[model samples]
Target: MTDRILLTCGEPAGIGPELAPLALESGVDFVWIGDPRHLPEGTAYHEVVAPSDPVPEGRLPVLPHDFAAPATPGRPDPANAPDVIEVIARAVDLIMRGESRAMTTLPISKQALKEGAGFGFPGHTEYLADLAGGVPVAMMLASTTVTPPCRVVPATIHIPLSQVPDALTDRVLEQAIRITHAALIRDFGIAAPRIAVAGLNPHAGEGGTIGHEEIRRFRPLLDRLRAEGMQIAGPLPADTMFHPPARSRYDAAICAYHDQALIPIKTLDFAGGVNVTLGLPFIRTSPDHGTAFDIAGQGRADPASTIAALRMARDMAANRA
Candidate 1:
Protein backbone atom coordinates (compact mmCIF):
# COMPACT_ATOMS: atom_id res chain seq x y z
CA MET A 1 0.00 0.00 0.00
CA THR A 2 1.15 3.52 -0.73
CA ASP A 3 2.02 5.51 2.37
CA ARG A 4 0.68 8.78 0.98
CA ILE A 5 -2.76 10.08 2.08
CA LEU A 6 -4.18 13.26 0.55
CA LEU A 7 -5.69 15.85 2.93
CA THR A 8 -8.04 18.57 1.68
CA CYS A 9 -8.00 21.79 3.75
CA GLY A 10 -11.75 22.45 3.79
CA GLU A 11 -13.08 25.97 4.52
CA PRO A 12 -9.82 27.88 4.82
CA ALA A 13 -11.34 30.42 7.19
CA GLY A 14 -12.32 27.68 9.62
CA ILE A 15 -10.18 25.73 12.13
CA GLY A 16 -8.66 23.58 9.38
CA PRO A 17 -5.51 25.70 9.33
CA GLU A 18 -5.06 25.52 13.08
CA LEU A 19 -5.67 21.74 13.16
CA ALA A 20 -3.23 21.03 10.30
CA PRO A 21 -0.17 21.55 12.47
CA LEU A 22 -1.30 18.97 15.00
CA ALA A 23 -2.57 16.52 12.39
CA LEU A 24 0.84 16.73 10.68
CA GLU A 25 2.45 15.43 13.86
CA SER A 26 0.15 12.40 13.87
CA GLY A 27 2.97 10.23 12.38
CA VAL A 28 0.92 9.50 9.26
CA ASP A 29 2.46 10.11 5.82
CA PHE A 30 0.21 12.75 4.27
CA VAL A 31 0.25 15.92 2.15
CA TRP A 32 -2.13 18.84 2.62
CA ILE A 33 -3.74 20.09 -0.62
CA GLY A 34 -4.33 23.79 0.00
CA ASP A 35 -2.60 27.16 0.00
CA PRO A 36 0.24 27.39 2.52
CA ARG A 37 -0.58 31.08 2.99
CA HIS A 38 -3.96 30.10 4.45
CA LEU A 39 -2.24 28.04 7.14
CA PRO A 40 -1.59 29.52 10.58
CA GLU A 41 1.08 32.24 10.52
CA GLY A 42 4.67 31.18 11.38
CA THR A 43 3.78 27.50 10.96
CA ALA A 44 6.48 25.45 9.20
CA TYR A 45 5.60 23.55 6.00
CA HIS A 46 7.45 22.15 3.00
CA GLU A 47 6.01 22.45 -0.49
CA VAL A 48 5.91 19.23 -2.51
CA VAL A 49 5.00 18.57 -6.14
CA ALA A 50 3.98 15.00 -5.42
CA PRO A 51 2.07 13.22 -2.68
CA SER A 52 4.88 10.72 -2.11
CA ASP A 53 7.39 13.39 -0.99
CA PRO A 54 9.00 12.78 2.39
CA VAL A 55 7.66 15.01 5.18
CA PRO A 56 10.11 16.15 7.86
CA GLU A 57 9.27 15.99 11.52
CA GLY A 58 7.61 19.09 13.01
CA ARG A 59 6.77 20.39 9.54
CA LEU A 60 3.92 19.69 7.12
CA PRO A 61 4.12 18.82 3.43
CA VAL A 62 1.86 20.99 1.28
CA LEU A 63 0.59 20.84 -2.31
CA PRO A 64 -0.37 24.44 -2.84
CA HIS A 65 -3.74 25.52 -4.33
CA ASP A 66 -3.72 29.29 -4.10
CA PHE A 67 -6.81 31.00 -2.68
CA ALA A 68 -7.94 34.32 -4.19
CA ALA A 69 -8.46 36.17 -0.92
CA PRO A 70 -6.52 36.00 2.33
CA ALA A 71 -8.24 34.06 5.10
CA THR A 72 -9.70 35.95 8.06
CA PRO A 73 -10.23 33.76 11.12
CA GLY A 74 -13.92 33.14 11.88
CA ARG A 75 -14.86 35.13 8.80
CA PRO A 76 -15.49 33.20 5.61
CA ASP A 77 -14.79 35.03 2.37
CA PRO A 78 -16.95 34.18 -0.63
CA ALA A 79 -13.96 34.80 -2.87
CA ASN A 80 -12.12 31.85 -1.40
CA ALA A 81 -15.00 29.45 -2.01
CA PRO A 82 -13.98 28.51 -5.53
CA ASP A 83 -10.51 27.64 -4.35
CA VAL A 84 -11.87 25.55 -1.50
CA ILE A 85 -13.92 23.54 -3.95
CA GLU A 86 -10.89 23.21 -6.19
CA VAL A 87 -8.81 21.79 -3.37
CA ILE A 88 -11.31 18.93 -3.02
CA ALA A 89 -11.36 18.37 -6.77
CA ARG A 90 -7.57 18.28 -6.88
CA ALA A 91 -7.42 15.70 -4.12
CA VAL A 92 -9.92 13.51 -5.95
CA ASP A 93 -7.88 13.80 -9.12
CA LEU A 94 -4.76 12.66 -7.29
CA ILE A 95 -6.45 9.65 -5.76
CA MET A 96 -8.13 8.71 -9.05
CA ARG A 97 -4.70 8.73 -10.68
CA GLY A 98 -3.33 6.44 -7.96
CA GLU A 99 -1.08 9.21 -6.60
CA SER A 100 -2.30 8.56 -3.05
CA ARG A 101 -3.64 5.61 -1.12
CA ALA A 102 -6.60 7.44 0.47
CA MET A 103 -8.00 10.89 1.28
CA THR A 104 -8.89 12.46 4.65
CA THR A 105 -10.79 15.78 4.55
CA LEU A 106 -11.15 18.72 6.91
CA PRO A 107 -14.60 20.26 7.47
CA ILE A 108 -16.31 22.27 4.71
CA SER A 109 -19.20 24.75 4.94
CA LYS A 110 -21.95 23.83 2.50
CA GLN A 111 -23.78 27.16 2.81
CA ALA A 112 -20.60 29.15 2.27
CA LEU A 113 -19.69 27.10 -0.76
CA LYS A 114 -23.16 27.47 -2.22
CA GLU A 115 -23.17 31.23 -1.73
CA GLY A 116 -19.61 31.65 -2.96
CA ALA A 117 -19.38 29.28 -5.91
CA GLY A 118 -22.97 28.29 -6.61
CA PHE A 119 -22.14 24.79 -5.43
CA GLY A 120 -25.26 22.62 -5.62
CA PHE A 121 -24.47 19.50 -3.65
CA PRO A 122 -25.66 18.88 -0.09
CA GLY A 123 -22.19 18.05 1.28
CA HIS A 124 -18.88 16.27 0.67
CA THR A 125 -20.47 12.83 0.52
CA GLU A 126 -22.75 13.82 -2.34
CA TYR A 127 -20.07 15.78 -4.14
CA LEU A 128 -17.70 12.81 -3.89
CA ALA A 129 -20.39 10.49 -5.23
CA ASP A 130 -20.83 12.64 -8.33
CA LEU A 131 -17.06 12.62 -8.86
CA ALA A 132 -17.05 8.85 -8.62
CA GLY A 133 -19.70 8.47 -11.35
CA GLY A 134 -22.80 8.45 -9.14
CA VAL A 135 -22.04 5.32 -7.20
CA PRO A 136 -24.30 4.42 -4.24
CA VAL A 137 -22.90 5.66 -0.90
CA ALA A 138 -23.69 5.61 2.81
CA MET A 139 -22.27 7.71 5.67
CA MET A 140 -20.79 5.77 8.58
CA LEU A 141 -19.65 7.35 11.83
CA ALA A 142 -17.23 5.21 13.82
CA SER A 143 -15.65 5.85 17.22
CA THR A 144 -12.47 4.13 18.37
CA THR A 145 -12.40 5.46 21.93
CA VAL A 146 -15.46 3.49 23.03
CA THR A 147 -14.99 -0.03 24.33
CA PRO A 148 -15.63 -2.49 21.48
CA PRO A 149 -15.85 0.56 19.18
CA CYS A 150 -19.29 1.54 17.88
CA ARG A 151 -19.97 2.26 14.18
CA VAL A 152 -23.30 3.56 12.85
CA VAL A 153 -25.04 4.55 9.60
CA PRO A 154 -28.08 6.78 9.19
CA ALA A 155 -30.53 5.39 6.63
CA THR A 156 -31.91 8.84 5.82
CA ILE A 157 -29.48 11.78 6.16
CA HIS A 158 -29.67 15.56 5.79
CA ILE A 159 -33.45 15.60 5.82
CA PRO A 160 -36.01 16.94 8.21
CA LEU A 161 -37.41 14.64 10.92
CA SER A 162 -40.89 14.80 9.43
CA GLN A 163 -39.56 13.64 6.07
CA VAL A 164 -37.48 10.72 7.36
CA PRO A 165 -40.25 8.13 7.03
CA ASP A 166 -41.06 9.02 3.46
CA ALA A 167 -37.43 9.10 2.40
CA LEU A 168 -36.48 5.85 4.10
CA THR A 169 -37.89 3.29 1.68
CA ASP A 170 -37.12 -0.38 1.39
CA ARG A 171 -34.71 0.29 -1.50
CA VAL A 172 -32.84 2.99 0.39
CA LEU A 173 -32.52 0.89 3.54
CA GLU A 174 -31.31 -2.11 1.58
CA GLN A 175 -28.67 -0.06 -0.25
CA ALA A 176 -27.36 1.43 2.98
CA ILE A 177 -27.10 -1.94 4.70
CA ARG A 178 -25.50 -3.66 1.71
CA ILE A 179 -22.90 -0.94 1.29
CA THR A 180 -22.13 -0.79 5.00
CA HIS A 181 -21.88 -4.55 5.21
CA ALA A 182 -19.40 -4.71 2.32
CA ALA A 183 -17.35 -1.84 3.71
CA LEU A 184 -17.04 -3.44 7.14
CA ILE A 185 -15.65 -6.56 5.54
CA ARG A 186 -13.43 -4.90 2.92
CA ASP A 187 -12.26 -1.82 4.78
CA PHE A 188 -12.44 -2.72 8.48
CA GLY A 189 -11.42 -6.36 7.88
CA ILE A 190 -14.49 -7.83 9.53
CA ALA A 191 -15.13 -11.13 7.79
CA ALA A 192 -18.82 -11.22 8.60
CA PRO A 193 -20.11 -8.05 10.29
CA ARG A 194 -22.96 -8.20 12.77
CA ILE A 195 -25.32 -5.30 12.00
CA ALA A 196 -28.10 -4.16 14.34
CA VAL A 197 -31.01 -2.24 12.80
CA ALA A 198 -32.56 0.41 15.07
CA GLY A 199 -36.29 1.06 15.29
CA LEU A 200 -37.62 4.49 14.34
CA ASN A 201 -39.97 5.00 17.27
CA PRO A 202 -39.95 4.78 21.06
CA HIS A 203 -39.57 1.27 22.49
CA ALA A 204 -39.59 -0.10 18.93
CA GLY A 205 -43.16 1.13 18.47
CA GLU A 206 -44.19 -0.53 21.78
CA GLY A 207 -45.46 -3.48 19.73
CA GLY A 208 -47.30 -1.29 17.15
CA THR A 209 -48.78 1.16 19.66
CA ILE A 210 -46.31 3.98 18.87
CA GLY A 211 -45.46 3.22 15.25
CA HIS A 212 -45.73 0.50 12.60
CA GLU A 213 -42.72 1.09 10.31
CA GLU A 214 -40.60 -1.40 12.27
CA ILE A 215 -42.95 -4.28 11.62
CA ARG A 216 -44.14 -3.14 8.18
CA ARG A 217 -40.77 -2.17 6.67
CA PHE A 218 -37.70 -2.90 8.77
CA ARG A 219 -38.64 -6.37 9.96
CA PRO A 220 -39.35 -7.70 6.47
CA LEU A 221 -36.02 -6.46 5.07
CA LEU A 222 -34.01 -7.69 8.05
CA ASP A 223 -35.63 -11.12 7.80
CA ARG A 224 -34.77 -11.40 4.13
CA LEU A 225 -31.15 -10.37 4.70
CA ARG A 226 -30.74 -12.67 7.70
CA ALA A 227 -32.01 -15.59 5.69
CA GLU A 228 -29.32 -14.89 3.09
CA GLY A 229 -26.63 -15.59 5.73
CA MET A 230 -25.92 -11.98 6.73
CA GLN A 231 -25.41 -11.60 10.46
CA ILE A 232 -28.29 -9.22 11.22
CA ALA A 233 -30.32 -8.24 14.25
CA GLY A 234 -33.01 -5.74 15.11
CA PRO A 235 -35.83 -3.48 14.60
CA LEU A 236 -34.64 -3.20 18.21
CA PRO A 237 -35.50 -0.08 20.19
CA ALA A 238 -32.99 2.69 19.45
CA ASP A 239 -32.85 3.52 23.16
CA THR A 240 -31.56 0.09 24.15
CA MET A 241 -29.28 -0.61 21.17
CA PHE A 242 -26.54 1.87 22.16
CA HIS A 243 -25.77 0.75 25.67
CA PRO A 244 -22.39 -0.96 26.15
CA PRO A 245 -23.85 -4.41 26.76
CA ALA A 246 -26.10 -4.23 23.70
CA ARG A 247 -23.39 -2.63 21.52
CA SER A 248 -21.21 -5.71 22.03
CA ARG A 249 -23.69 -7.75 20.02
CA TYR A 250 -23.04 -5.97 16.73
CA ASP A 251 -20.29 -4.43 14.67
CA ALA A 252 -22.52 -1.51 13.56
CA ALA A 253 -25.97 -0.06 14.22
CA ILE A 254 -28.05 1.05 11.24
CA CYS A 255 -30.41 3.80 12.33
CA ALA A 256 -33.51 5.10 10.55
CA TYR A 257 -32.52 8.78 10.65
CA HIS A 258 -29.50 11.04 11.14
CA ASP A 259 -29.75 11.99 14.80
CA GLN A 260 -30.72 8.51 15.86
CA ALA A 261 -27.35 7.20 14.69
CA LEU A 262 -25.08 10.19 15.44
CA ILE A 263 -26.24 11.31 18.91
CA PRO A 264 -25.13 8.17 20.69
CA ILE A 265 -21.70 7.95 19.05
CA LYS A 266 -20.99 11.65 19.55
CA THR A 267 -21.94 11.41 23.21
CA LEU A 268 -19.64 8.45 23.67
CA ASP A 269 -16.55 9.72 21.79
CA PHE A 270 -17.04 13.33 20.75
CA ALA A 271 -13.39 13.98 20.11
CA GLY A 272 -12.51 10.65 18.50
CA GLY A 273 -15.29 10.10 15.97
CA VAL A 274 -14.59 9.69 12.25
CA ASN A 275 -17.12 10.21 9.42
CA VAL A 276 -16.49 7.60 6.79
CA THR A 277 -18.16 7.52 3.35
CA LEU A 278 -18.69 3.85 2.61
CA GLY A 279 -19.11 2.42 -0.95
CA LEU A 280 -17.14 5.15 -2.63
CA PRO A 281 -14.65 4.22 -5.35
CA PHE A 282 -11.84 5.35 -3.03
CA ILE A 283 -11.34 5.46 0.72
CA ARG A 284 -12.52 8.82 2.20
CA THR A 285 -12.76 9.85 5.86
CA SER A 286 -13.34 13.12 7.72
CA PRO A 287 -13.59 14.43 11.28
CA ASP A 288 -17.13 13.92 12.57
CA HIS A 289 -17.45 17.61 13.50
CA GLY A 290 -17.83 20.55 11.16
CA THR A 291 -15.64 23.56 10.39
CA ALA A 292 -15.32 25.43 13.69
CA PHE A 293 -15.57 28.97 12.35
CA ASP A 294 -15.78 30.51 15.80
CA ILE A 295 -12.43 29.05 16.81
CA ALA A 296 -10.77 29.30 13.42
CA GLY A 297 -7.51 30.93 14.41
CA GLN A 298 -7.90 30.91 18.18
CA GLY A 299 -5.77 27.73 18.43
CA ARG A 300 -8.48 26.33 20.71
CA ALA A 301 -9.83 23.81 18.22
CA ASP A 302 -9.16 20.20 19.20
CA PRO A 303 -7.42 18.00 16.63
CA ALA A 304 -8.28 14.65 18.20
CA SER A 305 -11.00 13.88 15.66
CA THR A 306 -8.76 14.85 12.74
CA ILE A 307 -5.96 12.65 14.07
CA ALA A 308 -8.39 9.77 14.52
CA ALA A 309 -9.60 10.27 10.96
CA LEU A 310 -6.08 10.06 9.62
CA ARG A 311 -5.38 6.90 11.58
CA MET A 312 -8.62 5.31 10.38
CA ALA A 313 -7.89 6.27 6.78
CA ARG A 314 -4.46 4.71 7.03
CA ASP A 315 -5.87 1.48 8.43
CA MET A 316 -8.65 1.32 5.84
CA ALA A 317 -6.23 1.89 3.00
CA ALA A 318 -3.99 -0.83 4.37
CA ASN A 319 -6.93 -3.19 4.64
CA ARG A 320 -7.99 -2.57 1.07
CA ALA A 321 -4.44 -3.10 -0.16
Candidate 2:
Protein backbone atom coordinates (compact mmCIF):
# COMPACT_ATOMS: atom_id res chain seq x y z
CA MET A 1 0.00 0.00 0.00
CA THR A 2 1.13 3.51 -0.75
CA ASP A 3 1.93 5.66 2.27
CA ARG A 4 -0.66 8.27 1.34
CA ILE A 5 -3.68 9.73 3.08
CA LEU A 6 -6.91 10.13 1.05
CA LEU A 7 -8.82 13.31 1.89
CA THR A 8 -12.42 13.06 0.76
CA CYS A 9 -13.98 16.40 -0.17
CA GLY A 10 -17.14 16.99 1.79
CA GLU A 11 -20.14 19.24 1.03
CA PRO A 12 -19.19 21.41 -1.95
CA ALA A 13 -21.27 24.36 -0.83
CA GLY A 14 -19.66 24.40 2.61
CA ILE A 15 -16.16 25.56 3.48
CA GLY A 16 -14.65 22.25 2.25
CA PRO A 17 -13.50 23.89 -0.95
CA GLU A 18 -11.77 26.88 0.60
CA LEU A 19 -10.50 24.70 3.44
CA ALA A 20 -8.78 22.46 0.89
CA PRO A 21 -6.28 25.25 0.33
CA LEU A 22 -5.75 25.56 4.07
CA ALA A 23 -5.27 21.78 4.42
CA LEU A 24 -2.17 22.08 2.25
CA GLU A 25 -0.53 24.01 5.08
CA SER A 26 -0.60 20.77 7.11
CA GLY A 27 2.55 19.53 5.34
CA VAL A 28 1.42 15.90 5.28
CA ASP A 29 1.19 13.59 2.26
CA PHE A 30 -2.46 13.49 1.22
CA VAL A 31 -4.43 13.56 -2.04
CA TRP A 32 -7.73 15.37 -2.42
CA ILE A 33 -10.60 13.21 -3.67
CA GLY A 34 -13.21 15.55 -5.11
CA ASP A 35 -14.28 17.44 -8.21
CA PRO A 36 -11.77 20.10 -9.26
CA ARG A 37 -14.72 22.24 -10.30
CA HIS A 38 -15.73 22.48 -6.65
CA LEU A 39 -12.35 23.82 -5.60
CA PRO A 40 -11.94 27.56 -5.28
CA GLU A 41 -11.26 29.37 -8.54
CA GLY A 42 -7.52 29.68 -9.27
CA THR A 43 -6.53 27.10 -6.65
CA ALA A 44 -3.49 25.26 -8.08
CA TYR A 45 -4.05 21.49 -8.21
CA HIS A 46 -2.44 18.52 -9.97
CA GLU A 47 -4.60 15.72 -11.29
CA VAL A 48 -3.19 12.34 -10.29
CA VAL A 49 -4.52 9.02 -11.59
CA ALA A 50 -4.02 7.33 -8.23
CA PRO A 51 -2.74 7.93 -4.71
CA SER A 52 0.50 6.14 -5.61
CA ASP A 53 1.25 8.64 -8.38
CA PRO A 54 4.09 11.06 -7.76
CA VAL A 55 3.19 14.65 -6.87
CA PRO A 56 5.21 17.53 -8.25
CA GLU A 57 6.31 20.57 -6.23
CA GLY A 58 3.79 23.02 -4.73
CA ARG A 59 0.68 21.65 -6.39
CA LEU A 60 -2.13 19.92 -4.45
CA PRO A 61 -2.38 16.37 -5.81
CA VAL A 62 -6.03 15.72 -6.61
CA LEU A 63 -7.70 12.41 -7.40
CA PRO A 64 -10.64 14.06 -9.07
CA HIS A 65 -14.18 12.79 -8.45
CA ASP A 66 -16.65 14.65 -10.62
CA PHE A 67 -19.80 16.18 -9.21
CA ALA A 68 -23.24 16.82 -10.71
CA ALA A 69 -23.00 20.61 -10.80
CA PRO A 70 -20.72 23.53 -10.03
CA ALA A 71 -20.67 24.72 -6.43
CA THR A 72 -22.23 27.94 -5.21
CA PRO A 73 -20.82 29.22 -1.96
CA GLY A 74 -22.92 28.72 1.21
CA ARG A 75 -25.84 27.07 -0.60
CA PRO A 76 -25.80 23.29 -1.04
CA ASP A 77 -27.06 22.03 -4.39
CA PRO A 78 -29.07 18.89 -3.87
CA ALA A 79 -27.80 17.64 -7.22
CA ASN A 80 -24.24 17.48 -5.89
CA ALA A 81 -25.13 15.66 -2.69
CA PRO A 82 -25.07 12.20 -4.25
CA ASP A 83 -21.60 12.83 -5.61
CA VAL A 84 -20.49 14.08 -2.23
CA ILE A 85 -21.45 10.79 -0.65
CA GLU A 86 -19.77 8.89 -3.46
CA VAL A 87 -16.43 10.62 -2.90
CA ILE A 88 -16.32 9.38 0.71
CA ALA A 89 -17.09 5.84 -0.43
CA ARG A 90 -14.32 6.05 -3.00
CA ALA A 91 -11.83 7.02 -0.33
CA VAL A 92 -12.99 4.14 1.90
CA ASP A 93 -12.59 1.68 -0.97
CA LEU A 94 -9.09 2.92 -1.60
CA ILE A 95 -8.09 2.57 2.03
CA MET A 96 -9.69 -0.85 2.46
CA ARG A 97 -7.91 -2.20 -0.62
CA GLY A 98 -4.58 -0.94 0.83
CA GLU A 99 -4.23 1.65 -1.93
CA SER A 100 -3.67 4.05 0.95
CA ARG A 101 -3.05 3.56 4.65
CA ALA A 102 -5.47 6.13 6.05
CA MET A 103 -8.01 8.87 5.25
CA THR A 104 -8.87 12.29 6.67
CA THR A 105 -12.46 13.30 5.90
CA LEU A 106 -13.71 16.84 5.41
CA PRO A 107 -16.95 17.80 7.11
CA ILE A 108 -20.28 16.65 5.63
CA SER A 109 -23.73 18.20 6.07
CA LYS A 110 -25.98 15.39 7.24
CA GLN A 111 -29.16 17.41 6.67
CA ALA A 112 -28.14 18.20 3.12
CA LEU A 113 -27.16 14.62 2.40
CA LYS A 114 -30.45 13.36 3.81
CA GLU A 115 -32.59 15.86 1.96
CA GLY A 116 -30.64 15.59 -1.25
CA ALA A 117 -29.66 11.92 -1.47
CA GLY A 118 -31.91 10.24 1.06
CA PHE A 119 -28.94 9.47 3.26
CA GLY A 120 -30.19 7.32 6.13
CA PHE A 121 -27.28 7.30 8.57
CA PRO A 122 -27.01 9.94 11.29
CA GLY A 123 -23.50 11.05 10.40
CA HIS A 124 -20.18 9.99 8.91
CA THR A 125 -19.23 7.81 11.90
CA GLU A 126 -22.35 5.65 11.59
CA TYR A 127 -22.15 5.46 7.81
CA LEU A 128 -18.48 4.54 7.98
CA ALA A 129 -19.21 1.79 10.51
CA ASP A 130 -21.84 0.37 8.15
CA LEU A 131 -19.39 0.61 5.29
CA ALA A 132 -16.93 -1.37 7.41
CA GLY A 133 -19.49 -4.15 7.95
CA GLY A 134 -21.32 -2.84 11.05
CA VAL A 135 -18.43 -2.85 13.47
CA PRO A 136 -19.10 -0.92 16.65
CA VAL A 137 -17.22 2.36 17.01
CA ALA A 138 -16.98 5.33 19.35
CA MET A 139 -16.43 9.01 18.61
CA MET A 140 -13.36 10.55 20.22
CA LEU A 141 -12.61 14.27 20.39
CA ALA A 142 -8.93 14.59 21.10
CA SER A 143 -6.87 17.70 21.66
CA THR A 144 -3.76 18.18 19.54
CA THR A 145 -2.32 21.01 21.64
CA VAL A 146 -3.09 20.17 25.25
CA THR A 147 -0.20 19.22 27.54
CA PRO A 148 -1.61 15.75 28.19
CA PRO A 149 -3.69 15.76 25.00
CA CYS A 150 -7.22 15.45 26.32
CA ARG A 151 -8.79 12.44 24.58
CA VAL A 152 -12.49 11.91 25.23
CA VAL A 153 -15.14 9.43 24.14
CA PRO A 154 -18.85 10.11 24.41
CA ALA A 155 -20.82 7.04 25.48
CA THR A 156 -24.04 8.25 23.84
CA ILE A 157 -23.45 10.50 20.86
CA HIS A 158 -25.61 12.25 18.21
CA ILE A 159 -28.75 11.25 20.07
CA PRO A 160 -30.92 13.62 22.01
CA LEU A 161 -30.03 14.19 25.67
CA SER A 162 -33.28 12.44 26.62
CA GLN A 163 -32.13 9.22 25.00
CA VAL A 164 -28.76 9.25 26.73
CA PRO A 165 -30.01 7.94 30.08
CA ASP A 166 -31.33 4.79 28.47
CA ALA A 167 -28.53 4.50 25.94
CA LEU A 168 -25.45 4.93 28.15
CA THR A 169 -25.51 1.36 29.35
CA ASP A 170 -22.72 -0.75 30.85
CA ARG A 171 -22.45 -2.55 27.53
CA VAL A 172 -22.10 0.67 25.59
CA LEU A 173 -19.63 2.19 28.06
CA GLU A 174 -17.57 -1.02 28.24
CA GLN A 175 -17.37 -1.25 24.48
CA ALA A 176 -16.14 2.32 24.25
CA ILE A 177 -13.47 1.64 26.82
CA ARG A 178 -12.36 -1.60 25.19
CA ILE A 179 -12.25 -0.07 21.73
CA THR A 180 -10.37 2.95 23.01
CA HIS A 181 -7.94 0.87 25.03
CA ALA A 182 -7.22 -1.40 22.05
CA ALA A 183 -6.88 1.57 19.71
CA LEU A 184 -4.52 3.25 22.13
CA ILE A 185 -2.27 0.21 21.91
CA ARG A 186 -2.66 -0.58 18.20
CA ASP A 187 -2.82 2.94 16.74
CA PHE A 188 -1.35 5.26 19.41
CA GLY A 189 1.60 3.21 20.70
CA ILE A 190 0.43 3.48 24.29
CA ALA A 191 1.47 0.34 26.19
CA ALA A 192 -0.96 0.62 29.09
CA PRO A 193 -3.52 3.40 28.60
CA ARG A 194 -5.00 5.25 31.56
CA ILE A 195 -8.72 5.88 31.25
CA ALA A 196 -11.23 7.92 33.31
CA VAL A 197 -14.98 7.34 33.28
CA ALA A 198 -17.49 10.15 33.88
CA GLY A 199 -20.69 9.96 35.88
CA LEU A 200 -24.14 10.19 34.31
CA ASN A 201 -26.09 12.41 36.68
CA PRO A 202 -25.34 15.62 38.48
CA HIS A 203 -22.61 14.96 41.05
CA ALA A 204 -22.48 11.38 39.82
CA GLY A 205 -26.07 10.76 40.92
CA GLU A 206 -25.33 12.36 44.32
CA GLY A 207 -25.04 8.92 45.92
CA GLY A 208 -28.20 7.91 44.05
CA THR A 209 -30.12 10.88 45.38
CA ILE A 210 -30.45 12.29 41.88
CA GLY A 211 -30.15 9.21 39.65
CA HIS A 212 -29.36 5.51 40.03
CA GLU A 213 -27.91 4.64 36.64
CA GLU A 214 -24.45 5.49 37.85
CA ILE A 215 -24.93 3.39 40.99
CA ARG A 216 -27.04 0.59 39.56
CA ARG A 217 -25.68 0.27 36.05
CA PHE A 218 -22.28 1.89 35.39
CA ARG A 219 -20.21 1.27 38.53
CA PRO A 220 -20.56 -2.49 38.40
CA LEU A 221 -19.33 -2.52 34.82
CA LEU A 222 -16.39 -0.25 35.64
CA ASP A 223 -15.45 -2.54 38.51
CA ARG A 224 -15.40 -5.53 36.19
CA LEU A 225 -13.20 -3.63 33.69
CA ARG A 226 -10.87 -2.61 36.50
CA ALA A 227 -10.54 -6.23 37.63
CA GLU A 228 -9.27 -7.10 34.16
CA GLY A 229 -6.09 -5.07 35.00
CA MET A 230 -6.90 -2.13 32.73
CA GLN A 231 -5.83 1.19 34.17
CA ILE A 232 -9.15 2.89 34.96
CA ALA A 233 -10.61 5.37 37.43
CA GLY A 234 -13.95 7.02 38.21
CA PRO A 235 -17.62 7.35 37.70
CA LEU A 236 -16.39 10.77 38.82
CA PRO A 237 -18.54 13.85 38.54
CA ALA A 238 -18.33 15.29 35.05
CA ASP A 239 -18.29 18.82 36.42
CA THR A 240 -14.98 18.45 38.22
CA MET A 241 -13.15 16.01 35.95
CA PHE A 242 -11.56 18.32 33.36
CA HIS A 243 -9.64 20.76 35.46
CA PRO A 244 -5.91 20.93 34.77
CA PRO A 245 -4.98 18.73 37.72
CA ALA A 246 -7.75 16.22 37.00
CA ARG A 247 -6.99 15.96 33.28
CA SER A 248 -3.46 14.90 34.05
CA ARG A 249 -4.60 11.70 35.71
CA TYR A 250 -5.62 9.78 32.60
CA ASP A 251 -4.68 9.44 28.98
CA ALA A 252 -8.34 9.56 27.95
CA ALA A 253 -11.76 10.11 29.48
CA ILE A 254 -14.92 8.17 28.67
CA CYS A 255 -17.72 10.65 29.25
CA ALA A 256 -21.41 9.99 29.76
CA TYR A 257 -22.63 11.91 26.72
CA HIS A 258 -21.59 14.29 23.96
CA ASP A 259 -21.35 17.70 25.58
CA GLN A 260 -19.86 16.19 28.70
CA ALA A 261 -16.90 15.00 26.66
CA LEU A 262 -16.63 17.88 24.17
CA ILE A 263 -17.01 21.12 26.14
CA PRO A 264 -13.72 20.95 28.01
CA ILE A 265 -11.45 20.02 25.12
CA LYS A 266 -13.06 22.67 22.97
CA THR A 267 -12.55 25.07 25.82
CA LEU A 268 -8.92 24.00 26.26
CA ASP A 269 -7.95 23.93 22.58
CA PHE A 270 -10.78 24.80 20.29
CA ALA A 271 -8.73 25.32 17.15
CA GLY A 272 -6.84 22.03 17.37
CA GLY A 273 -9.38 19.44 18.47
CA VAL A 274 -9.73 16.37 16.23
CA ASN A 275 -12.65 13.95 15.92
CA VAL A 276 -11.34 10.38 15.80
CA THR A 277 -13.33 7.23 15.15
CA LEU A 278 -12.24 4.30 17.35
CA GLY A 279 -12.58 0.57 16.42
CA LEU A 280 -12.40 0.88 12.63
CA PRO A 281 -10.12 -1.45 10.67
CA PHE A 282 -8.31 1.48 9.09
CA ILE A 283 -7.43 4.90 10.46
CA ARG A 284 -9.88 7.82 10.16
CA THR A 285 -10.04 11.32 11.62
CA SER A 286 -11.72 14.67 10.91
CA PRO A 287 -11.77 18.22 12.16
CA ASP A 288 -13.85 18.69 15.30
CA HIS A 289 -16.05 21.29 13.67
CA GLY A 290 -18.85 21.24 11.11
CA THR A 291 -19.65 22.95 7.82
CA ALA A 292 -19.75 26.70 8.38
CA PHE A 293 -22.34 27.73 5.81
CA ASP A 294 -22.16 31.40 6.80
CA ILE A 295 -18.47 31.59 5.95
CA ALA A 296 -18.31 29.00 3.24
CA GLY A 297 -16.41 31.15 0.76
CA GLN A 298 -15.37 34.06 2.89
CA GLY A 299 -11.79 32.83 3.38
CA ARG A 300 -12.45 33.08 7.11
CA ALA A 301 -12.57 29.38 7.92
CA ASP A 302 -9.88 28.27 10.36
CA PRO A 303 -7.67 25.51 8.99
CA ALA A 304 -6.10 24.68 12.34
CA SER A 305 -8.43 21.76 13.09
CA THR A 306 -8.17 20.37 9.58
CA ILE A 307 -4.40 20.67 9.73
CA ALA A 308 -4.41 18.91 13.08
CA ALA A 309 -6.63 16.16 11.72
CA LEU A 310 -4.23 15.49 8.84
CA ARG A 311 -1.24 15.47 11.14
CA MET A 312 -3.02 13.14 13.55
CA ALA A 313 -4.03 10.80 10.72
CA ARG A 314 -0.52 10.78 9.36
CA ASP A 315 0.87 9.93 12.78
CA MET A 316 -1.80 7.26 13.31
CA ALA A 317 -0.95 5.66 9.95
CA ALA A 318 2.69 5.62 10.95
CA ASN A 319 1.89 4.09 14.29
CA ARG A 320 -0.09 1.33 12.63
CA ALA A 321 2.71 0.65 10.17
lDDT of 2 at 35: 95
| True-structure RMSD, every candidate | 1.0, 0.9
Q: Whole-model Cα lDDT per candidate?
A: 0.92, 0.91
At residue 202, give the lDDT of candidate 2: 93
lDDT of 1 at 177: 93
Q: Per-residue alpha-carbon lDDT of model 1 for 254-288, expressed as tens digits?
A: 99999999999999999999999999989999999
- lDDT (0-100) at residue 305 of candidate 2? 95
Best by lDDT: 1
Candidate 1, poorest ten consecutive residues by summed lDDT = 50-59
lDDT of 1: 0.92
Against the true structure, candidate 2 has what lDDT?
A: 0.91
Per-candidate TM vs. native? 0.98, 0.98
TM-score for predicted model 2 compared with the true structure: 0.98
lDDT (tens digit, per residue) of candidate 2 on 260-300 = 99899899999999999999999999998898999988888
